[model samples]
Target: MAISEPASDQRRAFVLDLPQRLVCLLDGASASHGRASLLLVVVALVAFLPGFFQISPIDRDEARFAQATKQMVESGNFVEIRFHTQARNKKPVGIHWLQAASVTAGEAVIGPSALTSIWLYRLPSLLAAVGAVLLTYWTALVFLSRRGALLAGLLMASCVLLGVEARLAKTDAVLLLTIIACFGALARAYVRPRAERTGDFRLAFIFWTAMAAGILVKGPMTPLFVGLAIVALAVVERSGSVLRPLRPLVGLVWCLLLVLPWFVAIWFATKGAFYQHAVGVDMLGKVTEGQEGHWGPPGTYFLAVWGTFWPSVVLAAMAAPFAWRARRDEKVRFLLCWLVPTWLLFEIAATKLPHYVLPLYPALAILGVMAIERGALARAGSRLAGLVWLWPVLAILVSLGLGGAYLWFGSGFGLAAWPLLALAIALLWMAARAFPRVGPEGAVLTAIAGALVLYTAVYQAMLPQMRALWISERLAAVVKEQGCPAANVSSFPYQEPSLVFLVGTDINYVLPNEAAALMKKGGCSLAFMDERFTGNFEKHAAAHGLKYHAVATISGFVYNGGRLTAITVYRSDDAPAGSGAAR
Candidate 1:
């Protein structure tokens, strides 16, 4: 009853052709303009809404950005940005203004509470993330099939980097929106009918306005990225005429009109200090030397793409060979023009962060979608089966990795992880069955859905437990629970900015050796020190003529490395005779 060689070969060929047929059908359905818009709307909601405010603001970026915006709300100084009296010069004022406006709107509805209202500060990022996804989809539709546009939108929605940035208070998500807007508009203008597109003025205005917003959000980096793309496109097309519709002379006027008012005002307010720090130190320093300890060799961003894009990265890698094969094609050349130089520039830059190349991710997503639409995966024959199976295999590994990471950090998997684990197992089965039955696109979509589930689990289950590790919320609660006066508390070694925001007090920063000096001026003072200083707390207290006892010990991870630290609270018995405290 075994099949003959010819029959088996025929069946195999039919199976291989299924993906192409399904993709064509999908492309036809996606061709409807309304469907694409609806798909983008769904991506926007899913990308921004769920778990947007599930956890508190994190340390470093989110906490710092939120605090700065909070200061703006309190001070009403829109031109000069400040984070509790320390000038915040790391970023342009655009993000702060947006955050402030969001907060203001939220206040009108829910009443103002800087200490509690995080969702308002995160709203702009959510909206911007949605805009980035929509614009990327629209851009893909310019040159790609309908199926490619849907895939591109879905891939971006499922990206771990965009997901994280969407829910946080940061500049990257907003910056991404502007990048997509400007570039997408340029693509539209370039590809449209020459008579209709040329001197459209409206498109030129959109491009310039988006670029202006980008300059305001992150400063010169915006113009640098867009300008570089323009030059690359001109070279690849071998014609300067392609750049004509951009109307640089008039566009520059529009850009300056949109961006200069605040720059001039801030210059007068900071006496040019803001520009010196934001432009000179934070911006150019990354080019001249490593900044913020982010120095890496050329391969940093190449490696980062794997983690940054996650499930989508597999397709991105799969797209490379096809892209190279079709390098002569104009659309392929345009995508390469967008992705290559931007990627290379980041790699060559002296300083690097994982999210620095976020603006280029839309291109990667587009290329990956194009590869799938062109039937690259199905054309691989038997190799396609293995790649399909890789999805479930990686999903299981990610589940185990998440659980193991928490346990390694001395945290437990919460109840929410149960559903997450079940979802992973389901994805494993779906991937195993789908490729053989449905097609590669089916398997890829399943994988992308699995990634969304993973992000949900991370935000709802893992982050709440991990919040205390990077943030001071729990530590601050402990101080309040112990009835310690805000004025009497001090942190030794260093003070995390989040601690100040969380504890609602000014914590004096002191060194360990200086602990004795604190004892002399105290009324039953309490000191928080790094765990390394715990053993010597009693010894130091006794040496300084004070009685000390450990109150509580709190620990968590605070930085990029998985290193954990314990913070110990110590109480002294001595009370200043004349210094009666107010409760």
Candidate 2:
């Protein structure tokens, strides 16, 4: 058992009191919004910025989002979302618009050549990630002390899912921001008594407007979660008090004002195809069954939360007993209502990805802090105390996973990552070892330290060094180095958006023979033939008298499909093309 905080506070301890002191520092910082905000920004940036610029554009969604936004920047089409003329109608225009703005600003500041930078496209996610972290702090303030709120903010900021989302050019990070804000407002209004909710009008605006932003970003997810939580709250409390303060009519009108313009414009532009795909295909498909291969049985999020939530998850486990025992507490009830129904919905849904439950993570963060403040965390003598070992064990497992992946796909031992991996494992071991002495909340800081080291190694060092996995980045590099800046490129038997985003919009997704034909057309034409179709490319090259030479042969795992994809770039030797090419 741990000593009471009141008892610990009496002593002027240094190392033993480090955890309490750290909590005090965060609490002190939260006294001033400016100082807290700055500190959180620094924390968020450190957590998010490791592989932000260094990593290549991830395939499928991230690349598709970036390409669509690049097209938006190129064509100045704000309403119609597209990926190289194909109507990307599955999503609304909010994230695309944000990404477009980020790219445009980047180009202006760093010259037009900066348009292709993946980091520029990812700016929205990064900034939105920061906003989400700050919002987590603010949201916790509604129900928690300043130190607890700050701790919640730190927990969310260092999270694995949020960190991954922050580095990608996708809607999740921004959606997370809007959802946190929207729920934060709703939580603020609901957790308090009706008489005490003086700023009902302001809360209503924040809730509805943030939900509106979520609507524009992912369409209906934000409102869906809020609606469900409110319904659950109403059922549990048997009161209209939660809904009465929001003034639904006015808030809905405000939300419509913010969200309708784009929907209406996209409706006019896509001839209502946007809604057909966005609703009928994208959103509904997930609800009905697995759209992509992301199918899992129930409790997927439960299993995944261990890794995705990471260090916080250790404390979350310790908080479970508290949650059940204190279920009737208004603060506990509010968080339970906010988390449980939404969590059950996602768990029961056929389509499951780790990030689908990201919005629920904030509730966990606040709840964990609440557990700590109340001395409700599972003690060393408790039956659930063995859960502490999960921290260090997961660290070792994660290290092994990384090292095993590198050994399987890398050139050498990946020496750059091993030291950090060792450090991460050590820190996590320390967290677990210190759990009995320092308690769950203090242990969280140590685990987060471990996570930071681990993520830095994974994102900054390990993943980047896995050159065999970034097929598109390497392909783009081959094309750029071949002395044909404006080469008409063809990727045979396979076309990925990352290639289009990094290479050019002029790429042709052609058959092996057609790729060879593109090469025969000469004038700086290059064909990127997948290894599976390399034989066909060569046969067509011979049959068509396409005089071409192999510029480079690259093999890597295509992240979209998670398979080995080998590509050979062949250039027609008939004529040099592009202004930069040798005549």
Candidate 3:
């Protein structure tokens, strides 16, 4: 009986230990999951919050897209998109469709005036930005550990180019989303091949479908990037057999089906005018001869842009050798394939823009994270620590110098921005003090975040006050007071489409030759002209027998040099006897 009693007590002890062990494991798993979820939420908030204050008005190509989408919605023509009285079929129909759909949905939910809402147009981009964050997180997880994924997300969310593009109503964000999605799917196909084997064809089909979506959103560059990366990865791994499951015929069929209808409709509707411009000029000529106004030096343009766009991540790029060393590791291999090929391709392109290289940013973020994880940044600690201390001392001296300069040269130096400068100094001091204790990684992140915050507070917060002091938002109100038809208003040399968008009018551009014809057609008009163009504009206006009276002038300062410029409005001398020919 004593032996049995002892055995029973031992069994009870083992059972008690089992439950406690299970509880510990469960608690650990929960903590990890919670941390990951919190990190993702923080990333999303960081990406979205800054845009709330920044207004992206119709500018350049954005104007073209907004005008086209507006026209399409009004015309109820889903297939063909038009802008500035011309069929613009160069870009695929995907973006226009998205805009139109948003406008429709917004109108239904928010009532009319939806078409004119910038937020409606910007909604898709905002959603795409969120998608980009989620995709970056998932992609990093696929190639790397949880910590790696968190770092990648942090890098991507902090990137300025991604932040800027995500705020604008453009195709780039959507293209990025699709590109990341396709790559994520490809990663899944590679990592979990056994699971994909049953539905391997379907998985490949979906991946290619995303590629097609990307192509439709941007152009051939989408497929080009995806294909190059995949092929390069396969070659590097010496595993062409991995690509055998991809169904080229099904992908082609899907792409043709998705893209053909719009192309055919555009061809018929424009009576082949679309073909000449879309195929011959916009698509083919852009690649061959380059666009008329937009051109760049062949090499290093992309590199410079990448450096500026994501300065923090670009700093990590110096650690590429460590990244290369880890190339045999699957995660590193994936990142290399994702980053290197796209970067090389863009670097080689003749036509380059800062935004064109946006697709490569996520891959670079991943690379940057990998580089950091591999201890590639440890070599810079001595220098980094020195800078952390040196930076604050230098900043304080610079701040004093700037204060002296401002006092000597100017008046009314407000204390509003001073607080930010002070805060920056404090952050620098704190970072310097914390460096030895927190280590290089924490110190670097702190410094980067401090710099970003200082920039945001100055540029975003201070600039608005300076702008308001210079340009009159009251111009729209004054124009309305003049009884000028909003549609009849025009600007010479340059166009302020923001005014047109706000006033719900078709703002006409008056070149030197057309000003006379336009004046004669519309007897009286309101116009705004930049002072820089005043000399040639006055000569042209005098030649056309037009009289003008200046109404209001607003002087605004440019931040770069604090130079002041004036925007002046004038009423036309000759009011058109009747409505001038439609602009």
Candidate 4:
């Protein structure tokens, strides 16, 4: 049944239409409609690379999570999270579970030291960020064109705030991804009306389940955000009918089933100490008291996000108008509901941090993509006219500014200096060559990603040298080498949990008043002192009749004001005396 070629006259007509067919194929390739999923994977990889390379271990909240997880793995205690030998019931166990899994897996492959590396601590967050990026792209595509979807992916990938979060071991990324997945599922359910009722039900159930998981990760705020967004979307769309398919009874059961086990276990184990700390202090008190020394003005967060999430900020701004214009549109309304409420809620809170607003980023990215697409079509003529002339002028100015910064502040013209200078020059050249054809949006985006990647790469390359200047790790190593039991060592004035985690020990703070009393009962005691606390130590130790000799002065790689002071470890004179040596 082979088909014969057409007659000569018919063949001539077919050949005449071949140009249109070829143009259609080219358009399809350019839009990359079939490969959108692949693009999302690529963007996620890009978002993850910086986090992978940057391994400057921070002794903050992330260190606490890692420590808790490590203890969980070793002790086989998965129900309650502990930090520095105390039941840390303030947060939920979702992040701990992820960290524990990463530690366990990494140990199997790379052995136990993986627990100490920044990568193991940060891997969960990085993976969650990747998931968030994929969800963001798919969510955007639900309502937007293919190009808009790509733009949204770009926005998420280039967001500095998200990038920073990806590199830290924190629950925020987990919370963010869970919320996003929920919303994405909901959006999908809404978009396809003829799609099976079962599909919608499944998606809704999954959304609620993810919310429950998020609750386990960061507590009630997860549901609070998800609930608010859903309510707002329902109100805007006048879609009272949309809620029916969610199957509230089944969904509620699912959520409770997923979340209650941990609560019950922790409640029984800690005899309600977990409940009080988690519900009373962690949730209510944290919001009202603004604990952990976190304080900010009402509008501070709005400004902070703007600075940290630059370039993405430009897209967010563009997206705002489109979101408003499409307020009646269900998809846009959903994104607006998610973005506006979450943003306002965080902004009004007494305790505000930059990462608190991460939930809104995906929504904002969607809006940005919409705005860019609309702008591109609306100003196509003007874009073509001005883009060619504007790029070279901007490139030259950027080049000069970069060169000036290096000449003024960087290590005055050495091998290190030249590489940075060369990078700057390359970026400038790229801007000049790419801007005319690609237009402002593409040019700006490419430049931002390039610049950030370059900066992150340089920072990561220098981190080992930078970390050597911090004595916390080295001091902790010394304590471990001496076979200091995990429970005995206490920090004075402040706590460096990272050190405790590194040394596989517990560290308690010696309150200003209790310092002397603790020193009197101490065994082979180690006390850390900096310039700020040297006076306090002298004043307290003299009052208590406790004598101390410096057992070690761990010099940090970085020095402040020609004084090589970071952390100094002291041994009590009561113990068998050892020589004070700098590590």
Judging by TM-score against the true structure, name the best candidate: 2
* Cα-based lDDT at residue 462, candidate 1: 73
Q: Rank the candidates by lDDT, best first.
A: 2, 1, 4, 3
Write candidate 1's Cα lDDT for 341-375 as tens digits. Answer: 88899999999898899888898899887887788
Pitting candidate 3 against candidate 4, the one with the higher TM-score is: 4
Which ten-residue region of model 2 has the weakest summed lDDT?
Answer: 574-583
Q: Write the per-residue lDDT of candidate 3 for residues 93-131, one digit (tens) a residue.
A: 888888889989999988767876777887777788777
lDDT of 2: 0.83
> Could you tell which candidate, 2 or 3, scores higher by lDDT?
2
The residue pairs found clashing in candidate 4 are 468-557, 469-556, 469-557, 469-558
> Rank by TM-score, descending?
2, 1, 4, 3
TM-score per candidate, chains pooled: 0.86, 0.93, 0.77, 0.78
What is each predicted model's overall lDDT from 0 to 1? 0.74, 0.83, 0.63, 0.66
Candidate 4 residue-wise lDDT, 1-583, digit = tens: 9987669656544433333343343234337745655655665576556436445556677778888888888789899788865888788888989888888888999997776776787888888887887778777878777666766766687677777788888888888889888888777766666335343577767788888989899988778887888787677666644554666678888899989988889889899998798889777765676766676767877788655665466446544555677687766677778878877877777787788888888887787667656664244444343333333343345446644544433333424533653553455345434444454454445545444544443344333334444456676776765545545555653455677677664565665336555656667666766656767776787888888776666555332233445556666666665555766
**Backbone collision count in every prediction?**
0, 0, 7, 4
Q: In candidate 2, what are the lDDT values of residues 1-583, reduced to their tens digit?
A: 9766664454424333655555566767778777787878888898898888888888788999999988888888788888975889888889988888888888888997677899988999999999999999999998888778888998999898999999999999999999899888888778777677554788888888898999999988888878888888889889767765677888889899998888888889989898898889888899889877889999889999998998788778778888998999998998998899999999888899999999999999999999888877644256766787787798789889878888887767888899998988877776776667766766677778778888888988888777787778777777777665444788876688888988887778878877777777768778878788888889989999888877777877776676887777888887663322211
Clashing pairs in 2: none
List the lowest-lDDT window of 10 residues for candidate 3: 574-583
lDDT of 4 at 177: 89
